[model samples]
Target: MTVSAPIASRADAGGGTPQALLRLDAVGRRFGDTVAVDGVSLEVPAGEFLTLLGPSGCGKTTTLRMIAGFEHPTSGRVLIGGRDVTALPPQKRDVGMVFQNYALFPHLDVWENVAFGLKSRGERGAGVEAAVTRALGLVELEPYARRKVQALSGGQQQRVALARALAPEPPVLLLDEPLSNLDAALRERTRDELRALLKRLGMTAVFVTHDQEEAFALSDRIAVMDRGRLQQVGSPEALYGAPVNAFVASFLGRANFLPATVDSVDGDRAACTVAAGVTWRARLAADSPRGAGARVRLMARPEALTLAAADEPNALRARVLDRRFAGAATFYRMETEAGPELLVQGGPHTASPGDVAGICLVESAQPVAYAAEP
Candidate 1:
């Protein structure tokens, strides 16, 4: 796959006026002397499904809360539909939120639970009933409308919460790991269902999760965070194919980082020589180190590598340290002669543990080279 350059802003790329429905301008949050979030800015256009992805304490949840008017930012502004809502309360923000726990009322039936949000907003009679019915229909939970929340399955309960949030027809929806409580199989099924439902409704949504697969599966764009700061933001393919830094490259998937030095620069490509004295050409971004003799690291995904004859051109000699069957693809762990360990994924091959093989990059593979940190 050809690696494209990281996009700094969607608006900048399109060369048009910003059409952001939800905007966070240098948002920051603090508690006592500890900083929870710092100087983060982002924009989510209308009808876009954006995900805030990171490990725990990375401020993704806090950022979502700020957008929903639950936690106030110490600095910057929050705007929804071109209106500043930084000081507004949750109910006044016109944003729907589905908590991680599904926050359902056990004593209430599905219909009543779905109607609660509208009723709390002083909506009653025919309008509340109609909104409730529409929301339930969207989630396909009308059959369980009369069933108690406690009697419903985990997935059903989650749908009830989603219906309640959507009943009000807010312009933006915030989901906080709503599928984390479901089993593996159910989570996968529900994830597909959720994506379909949201796309059908054209609902502008911001979802939060630490699972990279989940983010990749659902998001139109993903904003990755680390240490309470924004790391990178882009589509799944852009982020995975051309990571801006080492953190993003390592976090998105399994990659083999080979230490190398720049041997030559040719426009957007660089020739780097590894410790084993093997030279490889890798794609380079605009900001990548261009000077010859500059230290850098080549990032290659396991599936991009192939096994070949040791005498083949642009091949590295390596010994297979281990091999494992993984259904469709087998994984081979190898140690290069110069001492760097690498992983290759391919169809079943004759190579096994304790066997010597040639590790070569596939013709279509576009390995990225990042400047090594000091």
Candidate 2:
């Protein structure tokens, strides 16, 4: 997957690299006194799947609307294929949008619904038919093209919306939680199908969702937003492994934050004392305090911790409080002697509730330390 970068121009300064097909240059929007989006800039290379991920009302949907020309930005520009389209209307822009509701016409059948966009653009007769056929074929809904959208399943209705969007052959596609209506099992299967369909079509897509798992599964790169501001943008693994801040760390997954003080700093590493004489070496984040004695919090994911012998080096003495079986893995809730409770993910039936256990960071775990918030 191609990673996204902040490219202001069509290509790099030297014009040696492939141009970004979509660019949002410091775009912003306001609803009276409330800022919906603030100075969000991003560049998406052709065929890259970029997801805007955040909690509710974090400006992801607003950003998507700006790209789709449904809403105009109060400041900055929107560009597609290197051309500024900030002032263009929805139909004038070469982009397709799959709305959250699927927005299928109840009166129309799948074939007519899929042909709606093409027909609205003044396509006539066989041209419209061919485009609709091709779009349905792409989504493997050709057999049900004559079926009314109301008769289709939630997953199939979503495909009709996608087919309608694709019939226009837009270079850029915008998806706004297209799978939100489906059941959990169906959503998972549909997302896989959606990603495969988009990749096969070489579509440059911008997806908006609050679900981190969906973002992780579908995106080549994720742009995390918060409080109407862009926080960080990177590949899923990059963002998950080395988040820029506490918000990103906690939002991307379950993180255990232990209050600690920095004992020392050696380059990018920090020795942090979580409790009296209990020090753990952690990777220092960019904004982490450098000097010794600085208050900080050590962050470790549940999966990064393992059960160990009580006397093992760097192990924290803990007692298993409870356990939950979760299919492939079991989760253990433990309270450390250091006063912090931690969650650890391990194999099945390792320890039961009331069992005294030792919690240690796994070898591959490089815990991060962040300067404690005021």
Candidate 3:
């Protein structure tokens, strides 16, 4: 029988710290020679909204489809609330699903579509009607309950779709780019509304989206993927402040990679040489595997590098390559004699195309090392 989505205190539903509700253990999927998802593993806590974020062909959607049972893993397992669901069919696994297309029954009114699950379960009468009302109310679409889905606007249609999924109150909700079809304005509005609603309802949801901003805004934790491989999974701050490698540092935002050779070490500060035969001191984790006399790459973010008056300390003299005006910010790309092209953000500096300036990287900014790939 359909029950009101449990009103229990859920972390996102304004309750407590959310706990893991789903886990994918080294899950993988392959089609012939092309792998869709590679040994991807992650956990989503109950009532926490998690998003799988990546670019096209990054296997984020494929991962979501696997969880929805549209595709099966070629290897590994799917666990929901700690139980293995790797072999379960879509219907057998009590999961609520929202699709990118807002697939609603054209023939059925909003109320009917919301109640379709209950009807399928052989439910009848007042209980089904009450559940349908509650679901519609949840999405603030109760007024349109009797309207045919075919007659609704895209936003309205999506609301109906959400109502349908929520009506059954499944232990888990799977959203596959649910707001991708909406316009930018509507998309932002809907995303915020959806996040709040999911929180208030205490729903354990897995959201899939390619928009970095969307993932950062809506998710409690984000799982980043690339070429079917899980890249990094953490809060947005964690991913931004401490990226694990070059790909992550580059993908998450702009970065400057300067080639340096270790001169000496003072605990974490390794005197390293950059381009132009200049040496700079950089901090490294004590446990860093980098050794003296070895070539290393120094990483720092745009904000970390600032325009400096003198070419001293860890300063690099750079010639401006390009300047881009991006509304609230202007990013400048400069070619440094000692590092890969560096990007600087958020200063209203209007340096002409060929102006030269000294750059300063805040101490300990992007103190990371990459094992030089063989």
Candidate 4:
């Protein structure tokens, strides 16, 4: 049976019922001659988990800072619950921010740390104590309320930081690489914990990370950014199944791109010639507007390709150059006689290096195709 629950701390009423907690309308930012962000618009619904994902220097962090009121946009507007707050300061924005480095107070104990925000606002008595206890319990750090900030583990300290942010009961939480410093095991554990906590709390959140796995795991919606512009924005599945361009094709995951010319289209199915040397029927992108004689990059993820013999339709005969084992799956780099390099993946039954194998391209597996750059 399927289970259902809200993903935010307060989902029903805050930030307009998950329709939109915040929106960036044609927001742009510039530094001297370089434009950091350009005419980007995005809506973050309440109780939703959205991630800003991209490589470093791609304006992901700058976008988060703009929402935090730390960086002002060159143009466009920043809205919180549909109210324009482009010129508001951080304090007036009512947003809690978590940094890559957990910025906890070394001088304060766990309870004190969580209560710091309330204390600063002159909140006293049961209100302060109730908020602190509730925040501590949400992060599962109630047992460590008396622990010293410097004495906790990295993961624990990070939770404490999250609890501290939550104590203020902000409508939105912004996380900037909050788990980067943890070890592999801890990272995985924290990732799961954060997901559960966000859901249980029904709290709207925006997370920033360059890690694709992290973004995919934590975000209900992901906005892929590159070089000061949003490449694509959608659910992780949408981005993976239908990327827009070559940059996005290579970034999100492995893809074998074959130069192909469209031969014909029978509704959604199109027969295209690959590498100008072979013909294969490919499934076109969903809602793809371009068609017929348009030079396109035929793309397939590593999981999509299979090794096969020469003269086989949608198949490639090549010598395996290298093999890398990735626990659950194995990756193979194959070199074709046509000089086109392809990446192929096989599960536990993958081939070894130096083997001559015929790679199979699952005929039914259709990937998004992009217009080749001239």
User: For candidate 2, lDDT tens digit of each residue in 1-374?
Assistant: 22133222223444456578899999999999999999999999877899999999999999999999999999999998889999999999978999999988999999999998888888999899888888888888999988999999899999999989988788888999999999999999999999987877667889999999999999999999999999999999999999999999999988999999998889999889887656888999988889999999899999989997767777888999999998988999999998889999997878888988788878888999998989
lDDT of 4 by residue, 27-65 (tens): 999999999998889998887889999999999999999
Residue 92, model 2, lDDT: 96
Tens digits of per-residue lDDT for model 1, 230-302 = 9999999999998888888888988899888899998889988875656888997545689999988899999
Best-matching candidate per TM-score = 2
> What order do you get sorting by lDDT, best first?
2, 1, 4, 3
Estimated TM-score per prediction? 0.92, 0.94, 0.87, 0.91
Q: What lDDT score belongs to each candidate, Candidate 1 first?
A: 0.88, 0.89, 0.80, 0.82
Clashing residue pairs in candidate 1 are none
Best of the two (2, 4) by lDDT: 2
* Per-residue lDDT of 106 in model 2: 98
Evaluated at residue 218, the lDDT of candidate 1 is 97
Clashes of each: 0, 0, 5, 16
Model 3 scores a TM of 0.87
List model 3 lDDT by residue over 82-118, tens digit each. 7788999987777899999988888888888999988
Model 4, residue 349: what's the lDDT? 54
Return the top candidate by lDDT.
2
Model 4: residues >4 Å from true position, as ranges?
1-17, 275-277, 284-294, 310-314, 347-350
Estimate the lDDT of model 3. 0.80
Worst 10 residues of 4 by lDDT: 1-10
On lDDT, who's better, 1 or 3?
1
Question: Candidate 1 regions off by >4 Å?
Answer: 1-18, 285-287
